[model samples]
Target: MEKERSSLEEMLDAARKQFLEEDLTTLDFKIEELESRLAFSVTTEGGDVCAFCPTYCVA
Candidate 1:
């Protein structure tokens, strides 16, 4: 993020594009909210499931 007067806007093109060009208009919160994910594959070398999803959530 970069400073412009007061609010911070996303600077990277790749990251900014994900927001559909909507620049930052508010403060960013640090609290977690309704986190969720899914795992459909695994890494054979580590035999570890992909990130975040519970074991049962994996395929």
Candidate 2:
């Protein structure tokens, strides 16, 4: 489980980097649409919002 979580985090980090380096307007719109569909908000801090799904939530 730890290995899988690490791999997933790595993938999400890569995707977030790619999104930030590319066309941001379109990507932000797409992310917003996905968030609406998923019914969850990506975690934000210090004005930086993550562009991936919210999978780091603790219960």
Candidate 3:
């Protein structure tokens, strides 16, 4: 079990490193865009809302 867990962890770490090296710039841009949109919504709508959480929206 320990060996399997260690192998799985190593695989996950490798995959994460690969993703960071390959796609981190795109991910960062997407995150920045989302943040910008969220900021705009908060400022214009005067509320805090997330599309994923419809039940607890403050709008």
Candidate number with greatest lDDT: 3
Quality of model 1 by C-alpha lDDT: 0.41
Weakest 10 consecutive residues, lDDT, candidate 1? 30-39
Off by over 4 Å in 2: 24-59
TM-score of 3: 0.40
Candidate 3 wrongly placed segments (more than 4 Å): 24-59
Instruction: Give lDDT tens digits, candidate 3, residues 1-59.
Output: 99999999999999999988779788888999999887764534435456555444555
Question: All candidates' lDDT scores?
Answer: 0.41, 0.69, 0.76
Sliding window of 10 residues with minimal summed lDDT for model 3: 40-49
Q: Is candidate 2 or candidate 3 better by lDDT?
A: 3
Separate clash counts for every candidate: 0, 0, 0
Q: lDDT of candidate 3 vs native?
A: 0.76
Distance from true position, residue 57, model 2, in Å? 56
Highest TM-score against the true fold, candidate: 3
- Winner on lDDT between 1 and 3 is 3
lDDT rank order? 3, 2, 1
